[model samples]
Target: MKKLINNPNHVVEEMIDGYAKAHPQHVRVLSENSRSIVTARETADGKVGVLIGGGSGHEPAFMGYVGPGMADGVAVGNIFASPPPDPILEATKAIDKGAGVIYVYGNYAGDLMNFGMAAELAELEADIQVGKVIVTDDVASAPKEEKEKRRGIAGEFFVTKVAGAASEKGYSLEDVVRVANKANDQTRTMGVGLSPCSLPQTGKPSFELEENEMEIGLGHHGEPGIEKGDLQPADQVADRLVHDILADMPLGEGEKVAVLVNGLGSTTKMELYIVFRRVEQILNEKGIQIHRSFVGDYSTSLEMGGCSVTLIKLDDELTEFVDAPADCPMYVQR
Candidate 1:
């Protein structure tokens, strides 16, 4: 594949190295491992610790949210792969403040397996308390009766962000898990992909789509999309995606929403904004006020072309937590 890197195996290490160099005051890369923690300061003596991890391709994720109002540590894996148990345990130990640590991530099988194993090992090996929240926001993963079985998508961001903020606010591990689970319950997401991405190591695109084609319900790992359709206008595409998500959530009128229009790597800002306009209009028509909005590449799938829409119906607590100030290299809030 045409990757702008020195080596596939070294990509995570080198990228984290540069990330540490670029944001030393905010965070520090472990140097010898893919795990990262908040820069030496910002730890509480008896407060809860927060950690998140998953595959690598979905950047500004798993790790990117570690900062003042987010995660204390992040264990990362290979591209589209779960971080091994060692790093996961390392992250838990590194961030454990005396109270305990909370593990938060998506519900991907690989992520669940690795993180679960790590939690068990941490307890048996080190006597740590680590609870987890698996974000499952994709309606396309399972039947309506089995929505909890679906795969997670961009909504994982809201879960991670809100949950991390809760921990930073000194919530208990169980309470943080509850907050994350509640956010996941109120959130839903849908996506469209315009083209394929080449995995740096594989030297091949993960999937293929002809020009003027579009994929619906595509997950981050280049999973098969729900359906292939002809390219449509940004507004129309937004309608299809948002409507489907809302229908699944059955979100009614008068609720407040925090909308996320995320670029899946190669998507442009103009297209995202065009789609955002439609989303805003639709929610407005439904009498759902748009209180907060994130329109950018919060999470990416290598260099794939497309975007995803995430909507979280918010309550007072969730809104305040999301609005809380945060400073990270990629996503910054004030």
Candidate 2:
């Protein structure tokens, strides 16, 4: 209940205004739609447009990824709520440059419905061709055979990065969609929750956890995880998450991967690095090469105290795209 925000209802709007003001060099709110944000940089006429979005609270996402070599536009929604179709369509229109547009977002139900509606509107009313890649990377959410039903988590960063790089490289909408799907297919994530977070509006915790208890495989929006047990050491937690991920998608000896140890919200960097140390040890023992490592709060769920580990098995094509230069407000790569 203790938060630094004013007026729970106005948090989303105030957040957008502040973010745009702070990073005006990289992004701006859409003139016609306050819920949409677009890149401040000019885009090429024939290049494919990349648009990403989701609910708010996961900062530096959706909106933070709008810039050169990243998403060209974003349709932001309220906290943990999918945006309506109008802003999505507006963002689509604003970024479309005659070639086509590609949408990248999580595989949540609300997101699918809203984005689908926006795509139809773009095609029918705006005369713009649109494609989409839904991210399904949380292994704990569904079985391998039912991955399509899984929820997207931190692995969204990898999917969005690949989509943006492909679009920036002038890939057609279909190709962009293809590579994005490939990235999602190669990615897997598993999370552990040590505590719960509260919503500004209700001022109540989403879920409760005993002081010494933890939930394994928890979702970002407080969805129930698979198991609950007494808290264990960081290495044991890392082992459990990595074990599940590797079991779902086994990596061959000498295979390369991009590792992301992401904080849910309030988890400290020191704790994350300790977890990463164990992760690195596990992967190295398995002979899986770590091509790139990103350890921080890439995706979060308010101030929830937990972390998720994401691994994207990499091939040459995926490696190339992942290494492409990108400049955005929260995420930048060279």
Candidate 3:
């Protein structure tokens, strides 16, 4: 596979170094744990510390969200792999002030196991209180009755944002988790993959697709999607994704919502906006008011060519948190 990376084995380390250097004002790498990034901004002693973690390759995800008004610390793992308990615990320790710490991450097996162990380890060794909120918002991953079984996709962004905002508001650890869980429960996401992503180590695509074929509802790790079919227009794809999500969590007329149209990887901003245009059209036709919309590569899967659309049903509380100021390198809001 053609990639502009150094040794595959060192890609994650090099990336961390580069990111730390580039965004010194926002985050810093823990000297003892390179995979653990702590926000540069100081938080109040009584404020809950927000900690997020997950596998790498989804840049600006677990790490990029670390900063003021967002994640206080992030434990980054290898590409598509869970961070070990050591780094996870290190991240938790780095952010903990005295109140408590909350772990926010996608609902994946490896992530759950590692982060869960880290939480236990922290309590046993450091006497730190910890809580967790798993994001499971991919509507296409499971049936409506089985949302807890669905995988977390771009919807993780909304959950993380709400968690950070809640913590920044000085909410207690339990309240922060409660806010994040509410966001995750209201959020729904669906994606379409036009091409597969290649791993640096293997130098091979995770999956294959024909020039004219696409996989709808594909997971970030090349997990099975709803179906593969001939590629269609961007509007058609957007329609299907929006339809499924809305059906899963229907929005009332005149209801406020937040929209995120995220690129998986190689998908261009031009293409993402095209998808967003259709998304906006659909939401308008449905009388669902979009309070805010974000379009870009917020989350990615190496160089996969695809995009996911996320909608979070917004209430006054959620809107307030979502609008809270944030100053992360990759994601900043005022």
Which residue pairs collide in model 1, if any? 1-203
Q: After superposition, how far is residue 94 of candidate 1 from its true place, in Å?
A: 0.7
Runs in model 2 deviating more than 4 A are none
Q: Which 10 residues in a row give candidate 3 its minimum summed lDDT? A: 60-69
Deviation in angstroms for 33 in model 3?
1.3
lDDT of each: 0.84, 0.93, 0.91
lDDT of 2 at 256: 97
Q: Which candidate is the best by lDDT?
A: 2
Which parts of model 3 have CA positions greater than 4 angstroms off?
Answer: none
Give a tens-digit lDDT track for model 1, residues 1-334: 5778997878877777787888878887665455654545668776677788888887888668887777788887888888888888887777788788888778777888888999999889889998888888887667678877888888888988888788778888888889989999998889999988888777798888888899998878788878898999988899999988987887777888899999998899998999999999999888888989999998889888999999998999899888988877777898
lDDT per residue (tens digit) for residues 1-334 in model 3? 6999989999999999999999888888898898999998777888898898899999878788888888899999999999999998998888889989999888899989998999999999998999999999988888999888989889888998999899888888889988899999999999999999999999889899999999999999999899999999999999999999888898988999999999998999999999999999999998999999999988899899999999999999999988888889899898
Q: For residues 1-334, what per-residue lDDT tens digits would candidate 2 score against the true structure? A: 6999889999999999999999999998988999999999889998899999999988767678888878999999999899999999999999999988999999999999999999999999989999988999999999899999999989999999999999888898889999999999999999999999889999888788998999999999999999999999999999999999999999988999999999999999999999999999999999999999999988899999999999999999899988888999999998
Quality of model 3 by C-alpha lDDT: 0.91
Error of 2 at 267 (Å): 0.2
Error in Å for residue 100 of model 2: 1.0
